[model samples]
Every structure is written in C-alpha cells, then in structure tokens.
Target: MDFSFSDEQRMVQDSMRAFARAELLPKYTHWDRNDEFPREQWLKMGALGVLGLRVPVDQGGQEADCVTAGLVIEEIARGDFNCCYGILNSCFAGDILGKFASPAVKDTWLPAMASGETVLCVCLTEPHCGSDAAAIRTQAVRRGDSYVLNGEKSGVTLLMVGDAAIVFAKTDPAAGAKGVSAFLVPLDRPGITRHPYSDMGARGIVRGSLFLEDVEVPAGNLIGPENGGFSRVMQTFDYTRALIGLMCLGAAQATVEETVDYLKQRQAFGRPLSTNQGVSFPLAEWSAKMEMARWFCYRTLWLRDQGLPHTRESAMCKMQVPVIAADAVHDCLILHGHYGYTKDFPVEQRLRDVIGQEIADGTPHIMKIIVARDLFGRDFV
Candidate 1:
C-alpha cells in the first residue's frame, strides 16, 4: 500500500535529478552534433556511484537494489537519453559478472568498469538474427586451455568505445538455446574489428558491429556453466526491460514539461495557446498516459527487488511504454509546429532518440509472444 519512496531513495533521486540538469542536459546536444562519446560525463556518473548500482560493494560498486537503479536511470534520461545507455550497459555487466564471473575476470574488469576507467558491452544480437537470439551463428570451440570465438555481433550499444565484451557464442549448435555460452573478451585482442553505424538518433553512444575471427580467451573467461549463458542473459533482460520503460518515460516527461511552458507564453489569435482545449488536451492526455506507464514500470522494478515473478510484467512494460513514449514525443513535435522540426528545440531530437528504443531490447511482436506464453502456459501458447 505504501507508494512513497524511502528517505534513502529520495536522497538518491534528488541528487541524480540535480546532476542531470546541471551536468548532463547542457552538453546533451553537443555530443550528438559532434558524434563524440561523453567520456567525461561517464566518469562523473562513476564518481557519483550511479554507474555501479548493480555491482557488488566488495568489487568497488554501490551494489544498490534494482529500484534505486531504476530511479537513477530515469532521472539521467531526463537530461541526456544517450547517456542512459552507459548506465544500462554497466548494470547488465555488473550483475552478470559479479554473480558468475571468475575472481580473476571480476578482479580485472569489475573495479575498472565501476570507476568508469573501462566499459563493457553485451554481445547477443547478430546481423542475421535479433529477435530469434538463439539462432545466432557465432561459434566458440574449446582448445586445451582457451576458447576460440568467431562471429559477427551487430546492434551492440556502446561497442565503439567498449573496452571488453561479454560475447555470447554457441558451444553446441544442436542444443538450441542451451548450447550458448558467454565470455569476457578484451576488445584489444587480435582478430577483432569494429565498424560504427550512422544512426539517425542517439549518435553519441555509437552503436556498432563487432567482428570476431579466431579470437582466443582463457577458459576462465567463461561465465556461469558451460551451457548456462542463455538463461542468465534472459534473466538480465527481464531487469533491463523495466529500466528501458522508465528511461523513455523520463525523456517524454521532460518534453511534456517544456511544451507546457511554451504553450502558456505562445500567443495565438491574440490569446494564449494554452486557453484552447484543442491545443492543450493532447498534452494533457499524453501526460496521463505517461504517468500511468511510469508507475507501472516502477512497480515492475519493485517486483524484481522483492524476487517475485515479473517476467510477464517486464515484457508488458517493454511492449507498451516505449511505443507510448514515442507517440507522445511525436505529438509534442507537432505541437511545436515549425520549430519542432528544427534542431533549435530538443523535441525533434527526442523523437528520434525515443524511436530507437522501440526496437532495442525487444520488439513489440516478440514481447507479445513472451506475455502470451506466460498467460497460457508454454504448451498452450
């Protein structure tokens, strides 16, 4: 019944909100225009302890709960949507490595990643397969003391600047999903080539493809069991699906607030535009939708904190919230008229940024399948 955040949660939220407005918002467009990575801001986020919320305290991270991590990402997205990608990558890498990686691997990467001295990316999607993740063609074969990996991973976020990658490859192709394994491969290793994309939005993060040819790593780099990586990554996605919802909602909410101010001062037909229900009702409607979606996402993250069944809830958030956020931003752009189309206002950028998320974690079609399978049971579905 209690819906309010705790004192500690409030403190974290207030600090991140202020940091977003002061440090991140001012330079948000600068990085996009220049096609540069926000390394300085990434370090600042590390110093603030936001980058390691899911990493263990013993491993140089805050090791905060899932709900607190959700708050941090949402607030940051309000200032810079692309920067939220860093938080997402860190949390995924932190949780997966802290729990399952060997001491040597964890010792080398976890602390540096938490300190923002290095970055890690998850390599699951391939050029040939995205939604059907199990059908990936990446292959890893065991040698006497090392595993040789050869595959092309596409649609990776932050790959251009990633120091290492949690690469997933098929160790037993006949076993389907159970045959997959994960490895911590340093990007500087030989036989690795990277190619960056010219994305329409969020160009600051620099999504790219990782081509691995005969890349070798020690056996100790294997995460979890020999064939347990598929389930481990899917579990991590459940946590991130809710986070994605909040991230998009943050950007949309900021646009809503900005449009409200613009509407009130804008004169139309010798009267303020805010006076007309036609001009104001869409904003009001989208506001209510986003508010409802925001609370749902929070509840989903809370369920994760409590270790409850939330796969269905997480899929629902992924399925609906981003679409709602994208629609709201598109409508807000229309409201801004000619100015919204131009880079003069952030609305246009927000629209392009928000749309990428609609396809990132899981498309609506795939998410629908997850929810349907849950509702009717696997056999029935």
Candidate 2:
C-alpha cells in the first residue's frame, strides 16, 4: 500500500506549515496571557481557507478530503494549538451541516462560517452528562413551526464567541438515545444564556456552558431527522477523534523541536544537554511514540476517506494519542529544566493546552470502553 502523500497534499502541508510559523507562532502566547480570544487570527485562518477544509467548494470551502483536513489541522496546531480548535469546530460543523441541514440553513451559515464571519459550536455534553451523551436531559419540544428548547449544555468549546450552537436535545425523552435530536439554535435566541469557564488550558478557545431556557428555533433547523441525532453525532465523533489525535500530536511535535533546539544551545559540563543520554533518551522515546501515533491517526482518516469501518481505530486514536502527547509535552517541559515551568517559554503553555485535550472529545476511559466493546463484542463488554 502506498503511504506517501500526493503532490497536492504535500503542497498544502508545506503552505500551512509556513503560515503557522510566520503568522500564528509569533502571537501564540498573547491570547493565553491576556485571557483573550484569538478572533483576529481566526479570521485570518478563515481568509486562508483553514476553517473551510470540510466545507463544500460551492459553499466557498476547499471541500478537501478527510486526510487532507487532518494534515491542515496538524500543521496549524504546531504554530498555535489553541487556534486549531477553530478548524476542529469548523470541520465538525461543516460536515454536519453540509450533509444534513436544509438549503436555507446551509446557504446562510456554511458560507459565512467558511468566511470566518461566524462560529458554530456543538452542544452535546450537559451539566450532568458527558460520555453518557444519551443521558442528556436537554429537551426540545415542537411548537408549531419551531422547536422550543430548554436544557443546559456544559463543556461547549467556543461558546462565548459562537454565533450559534448545534444543540442536541431529547425530543422524546422516553426513547433515550433515539429520542435525541439536533438543532441549530442561534445564540441570540431570547432564552439562551451563556456562562464562560476559566479553563486552565485552551483558555483562548473560551469553552463554556450554554443554557437554553425555552429557546426557540425554526423546525427547519433540525439536523438530519428527529431521533437520529445520536448515531449522527457518534459518526461525527469517529471523524473528530482522529483529528484530535493529530491536533495533540502537532503540539507535542512542536515542543519536541523546541526542546531539541534549546538542549543543543544550552551547556552542561562543557557540553550541550543533548550530549547526555538521560536528556536525549526521553526525547527520542517521545519522538518515536508520537511518530507511530501520527501515522495511526492518518490511517484512521484514510479509512474514513475510503468509507470503511474505523470506529474501533478512531477509538484507539482517542484513547492513546492524547495521553502520549501530554506525556511527551510533560517530558519536554522537564527537559527544559526550571525554565519550562515559567510562562516565558511556550513549553509550559503547550503543556497546559495539550493537557485539556486529554479530557476533550472523549476521555481516555470512555475511549477505552468503546474499543473494548468492539473487541469483545458489545454483549460481553
């Protein structure tokens, strides 16, 4: 099997890497330092088509393949890990809307979203549920031409600055997972209120909780069909899980490069820190692990592009990559000595930023359960 990227893919990868280094790396720390959102950078990314990788070409997007999208996010993450969130959310929103939303909904939001003029967030996790998404208590009741929604969705990334949310709620509470339905609800809706969180990492992404108190949206905003939201979201998660792996890997890879540079220039006992096996060995190990994880992620994305079953592979990516990335960044931090602990260097912030991903998407525990279920049969697991 051919493992090489096509010429077009390589060109896109190089261009994104250059963009990340020149534009995003310089100001990566500014947003986290001031607890500010990277709105301008996000807009720039939109202008660069980074936010539109999953959108259709007719909708002003590249409509790139899944593997290509993965490549773009990985390169972007190297420069600014937090900015990668915009691409991640956009890809998720683009795919969901492109395939399911009504013509009006698609025409209005997709182009604007591709242009970076608007942001959309997925609201699935609730104050009471996360991996147990089916247990979400958010309710959306039909009201003639609209659905009146009421529920609390916690851990919504980009919520504070988002224009709207793809809110998943139960239309028929008795049906459990089957009862869940997805809606594209504008954040400005009368009963919608937002509360931003003061997260330790990825603060620039501004994750928060969305509270819908009798909020209303036109019935046409329904994504897919009623009672079909759960499976749709699960399928989406399979795609994003692979992206998450690449995203975290980019951060870890960047940290490794930075550590290598520092170690070579810094001296210990009249020699560079890189001369020591102790210092170099950890970096070596991490590099190898991250390389393996990166290929696994790309293959998972490849499987997706081929329309093959990769739910188990995606779960493995989610379960293993972030932990590997976090550990690699942590070691990179330690390798930098006491300086790594300070905010003066990007390593500390990278550590903080990378750690949050360990919890985001799906926690390792939840991911492991998915893998286990697949391997041992659903009944045994």
Runs off by more than 4 Å, candidate 1: none
In model 2, which regions exceed 4 Å deviation? none
lDDT of 1 by residue, 1-381 (tens): 989999999999999999999999999888888999999999998889878889989889998988899899999999999989988998999999999999999999998998887988989999999999999889999998999999999988999999999999999999999999999999999999999999999898899999999999999999999888999999999989999999999999889888999999989899988899987999999999999999999999999999998899999999999999999999988888898899899999899899999999889999999999988989987
For all predicted structures, in order, the TM-scores are 0.99, 0.99
Residue-level lDDT tens digits of model 2 in 229-336: 989989989989999999999999999999999999999999999999999999999999999999999999999999999999999999999999999999999988
Clashing pairs in 1: none
After best superposition, candidate 2 residue 343: deviation in angstroms? 0.9
Q: For model 1, what is the error of residue 347's alpha carbon versus the real structure, in angstroms, after optimal superposition?
A: 0.8
- The weakest ten consecutive residues by lDDT in model 2 span 54-63
